[model samples]
Target chain A: MALEGELAAMMAAAQRGDAAAYRALLKACLPVVAGIARAQGVRGEAVDDVVQDTLMTVHAARASYDPARPFLPWLGAITRRRAIDRLRRAGRRPVEVHDPLAFEAEADPGPAPGAHLETRERGAALARAVAALPEGQRQAVEHLGLRELSLEETAALTGRTKGALKVNLHRAIKALRASLTREGE
Target chain B: MAARHEQLVEDLAGRLAPVRPLPRPGLRAAAWLGAALLLGAVLAMRFAAVGMEGQAPADFQLAMVGALLTAIAAAYAAFVTSVPGRPVGWALLPLPPAALWLGASGLGCLRAWVSPIPDLHGEHEAVGCLGFLVCVSIPLSLLIVAMLRRACPLRPNLTAALAGLAVAAAAATLLAPFHPHDTALVDIFTHAVVVAGVIGVNVLAGGRLLTRG
Candidate 1:
């Protein structure tokens, strides 16, 4: 209660254009905002981002604060909002793959005999499976995957919708994988 | 990161200027509601001068009260919920009044459908009513949205929706005085569609407008 009152007083002064008091208020708010961010499941570097966002909101919205109202809950609400926004953005974006070596071994200790023959057979089987796809799927695979054309180019060449090309490409890959698996078996 | 944080504090402090805080939500709501009612009254007087034809239905006053209360509640909610930490449930404050308004209007429409009052006035044009509602609501929405923009609403869509409801309800209240005719099913449906449209546009665009600052 004392802390809340103290913070409220600082904010009240800040609203009155007390520069030093404003600085003190923001400095005091830093850890509380960060703590709130962490509690909201924001981790590591993103915690700093949420802190910055929340402070910016506070700065922009300072006049909206009521002196009669407790400051902490107001601050808490802003902090939680920014934290959730950051989390939602992270959810929408693709996760970055930092180190490939984390997923794959750094070095293969040894190679089995007939590896070259196995690779050739697998490649041939993949080719056959791709060829057996529906015309649209085959074209999508040929232009998008095998020839590595950009989606725009593939769509123009095939007169197919970009959406259709994507669906076909996805289906082609799935069919190729099943076909290759059956051949290996 | 720590140095940057310190720098931000310095920057904010450097820019600090005394600000007169906004009035409390209730007070702000009252100010806005007053302006809206004044405008509504002016519009009603204009329509009445132009010689709107039919008599106001028995339930007209009830619907007007409902709509007026809705505007007050919704405007208040819009301002209150725009401040962070306020419950989102504040957005629901206008629901009861909204229901009352809708029910009264629906009953008016039903009565019209059942009895088929001859177009005695013949002056009430559905398009005119639509035009009046749309025109009246636009300024109301714009004014309230401008006021709401001063605060940081975490849920901009919800806040804007409340503003929309307030504007729509206030505009609808004026319709009783402006048109002074029994509402046909088409007329009531038109009102519903316009109300939904106002709220929809607010939810879609008003949120962005509020956050643009």
Candidate 2:
């Protein structure tokens, strides 16, 4: 209720082109946007771009906002769209290949290292693993493991047989594990 | 070279700013009008196809039309008033309407379920309502990421929006089997495409506006 009223006032001020109000609204919404971006696997420098785009969008579309409705969801909807768009434009570049499995695996309760340090180590290890794989194996792992394609799907995508795909996946996973383990040691 | 990089960043920062006060109201209205026409054409086609079967209600159909228009208008107003510059603001403006459309469409479908309509059975109606929500949601989620990009200018909103859209598309594919065979896939695919198109237009418009501005 009180929050809603404050949001309404802020929104109203923003609508009237009050830069301060616009900034405040954006400031308030930043964490939400950032959290969503990070959750969707965006990181480092790209995070800032995603946030900027989201805020610019929100500010640009401020006037069309109805005070009668909730604001966060409206803001959230825009953030999600912008993030997806950024992802598409970036293409399938090697630098953007953050391991989704490692990301998930690292999220659980683990050893005593600082979260940041552990994440960096894991990330570096994962990068090395991906770099070390044979081209065909790397491609298979990238599509099947990182991108979450199933064996059959990966086979279809790569024009390999089911047997060949399993072999590729097995070798890829084994190589990645060995590489990561060596890095850790 | 350092100065050049700084200047480039500054220029990009400026270009990425949310508020673009349009010099001419007429141009703003025309841009919005074009958006409306595009939406109307899609809706008309949807209604025409549905109407051919003669199963949908006139009042319900009218309500859907009205809701879409209102959602788009509200969105435009929200986006325009919030931002400061022309082109950037204008390009980023369609997000609000797109969001509203999703919300209203979801709510409308939900409401239809609650109403005493005897046409769709319990399971089918539930599936339809769920399908509509999911269809609209995929885009709404994408739009939210887009808005964040405009707000921060740190990461490109396009990346976030596409990644989110791709994820949503994948999720929808996974869920497609549970939905009704006739309308479910078509509805979701169409909604996704429309939402994607809207985002694409916003990006193109922003690019043009940034260059011109």
Candidate 3:
């Protein structure tokens, strides 16, 4: 409560032309915002971006501050929004509740490089096999496997349900594996 | 990191132009009440009072008072919310007044229901009453929004919504006296729509727009 009260007072002073207090508040808020973003499951490059965006948002929305309210709820709301926006931008919006039941079926990638000519032939064979699939399967492979979009984002872009996208992706992977195995044999 | 801090500090200095704490709620409440009264007087001069044109409802004055109180309380709440870190509960300041105003509108609707008057749907005078309310609210809202923007509300939409609600309700107060044609329910429904519109617009976009602070 003291920290909360302290931040609120600093925020008020910062509102009142106290530049030093403003800087202190921003600095103090950085780690907190970053932690919040991380807790939302943001990782690596996206983490810093979300934190930066939250900071910028906080700076911009300072006028709407209410002295009667706890400061964290306001900050928390902004932080969560910036994190979601980041996730949305990355095309990684999670579709399901993220249980263990989900399967991420990647397109059969070419085997690890052996002889250079063999690698080239196998890569070409894999590409041809992918191209031969139905358009829906091909699109699913490209979006979910090649571009690494989540099921939700792929569904959104393709105007299909998550279930449909998952089915298409799974089928594409199965077809690719069979085609590659037959060619190898 | 140090460089970022320095830059942020510099930005804060640049942004800190004129820091004005919101006026006390009582002061803001009184100011809106006075402004409503003054505007009502002027409107009365231009167009005769509703009583002059027809036998005004018995609760017209009471409804006007309720609207004024709504204006006052909401204006105070808006001001309080604009200052970041204030308790969220302070936004509740307008609830009682808003309820009072709504209750008064209910009575007016009840009266309209029993009497020969059109209930809510047929009140064509609503158009003019709404117009008058907007006319009064626009300036009041601008002033409050200006105040809110200076404070740099953390929740820009919430602050803007309250500011809009306050001024619009303030305008409704003045319109209540001059508007004899609007049934109570019409005032409530129309005013609610306008206020919600204000809130929605601010939430969607105004929050981004009001960040000058």
Candidate 4:
């Protein structure tokens, strides 16, 4: 005798392009997926991200499931992979140090008008100047400087090697200084 | 932008398109039956050319049938177990047929169970036997995997292992007629080693390929 069941049948219908069935199946599997993720040591925002990623992975991999078979092992496999991926990604990223003065305004106000104008001009010039650098440098500035992201974030988001990101940032800053100096004249 | 769960499900469902399932087990069996017949014909032709003729013994005949049966059952097991949460015991479907095959080997198989110390410097022909078994198993395993590709397999290693076993069993059966100086000990030993090696390799490497997320 074979075990006949709901999850497999639901998934089968979902794969048939039945929107309602797909939603219902996804809803049903969420708890099990979440539980699996939590059991694997994923916590907080990362847990939800892992779960979402698992859902997306499953959606992408849905066609590989057989309706005739029981469904847990297939779901478990995908869930396990996503969770592992998240863990690795989190593990490899550098922690961002806290800045005590981040929210606290400068203790003393700087010299006004002329400096601000020079700074404003420099800011405008830097924005325009950044565009002139090579694409890699430009991207590094965009993520690390303009976006105020940490090196780890930039590396993770852009999928660039950390060393490459550092080089690009350094080069971009050097290029900007040269461009700004020319503008100063 | 909002809840990741609803957003993902909504996104996937919005873009979802599903294809027709592969033909049922009966059709698959029929197709394999054709493959078996073709292989039998090829073997027959080779036998004729070699001026070799002999009736397949009663037990070997049963062994051949068992191999084919194991292949089919294990293939189905691989497909079924691809579904998430399926009982792992489904992977055991190959057992009865496997039992029949070894039983057909008679006491000679049991007597030959004394394996020599394993060696890296094995005879060239023994290495050739491994290659031959793998060559036969690959196509059969690929077909099994392709059939199950429509189903999401949760246990990639287990699913792949079963498929490997099935394909290896079928390959082992095919090797019998061409093998020189066949003995039950050699037959059982060779097939077991071949099947185990193939399954081990597949179970190790096939996990990601079968259950890629």
Docking class of 1: acceptable
After TM-score superposition, the amount by which residue A54's alpha carbon in candidate 4 deviates from its true location, in angstroms, is 3.2
TM-score of each: 0.76, 0.30, 0.57, 0.55
Best by TM-score: 1
Residues A7-117 of candidate 1 have per-residue lDDT tens digits of 999999999999988898999999999999999999999999998898889999999999899999999998998899999999888664545765475566677788889
TM-score of 2: 0.30
TM-score of chain A of each: 0.53, 0.46, 0.50, 0.49
A20-48: candidate 3 lDDT, tens digit per residue: 78878887887888789999888887887
lDDT of 2 at A2: 71
Error of 4 at B149 (Å): 3.1
Which is the leading candidate under DockQ?
Answer: 1
User: Residue by residue across B1-213, what tens digits does model 1's lDDT show?
Assistant: 988889888988999999878889999999998888788778756666443445566676677789888988999999999988777788888999999988888888888888987764554477888899889988888889989988788888889989989888988877766564677787888889999999998888898998722
Question: In model 4 chain B, where is the ten-residue run with the lowest total lDDT?
Answer: B113-122
**When superposed on Cα atoms, how far off is each prediction in RMSD?**
19.1, 26.6, 18.4, 20.1
Question: Model 4: C-alpha RMSD to truth?
Answer: 20.1
Best model number under lDDT: 1
Per-residue lDDT of candidate 2, residues B1-213 (tens digit): 324333433443344334432323334434434543453345345533322344444433433444344344433433333233222344344345445545544554555556634444344545454554455444444443344333332223443333233223223322232333233333544555644654464445433332110
Interface RMSD of each: 1.3, 9.4, 4.3, 3.2
What order do you get sorting by lDDT, best first? 1, 4, 3, 2
Fraction of true A-B contacts recovered by candidate 3:
0.28
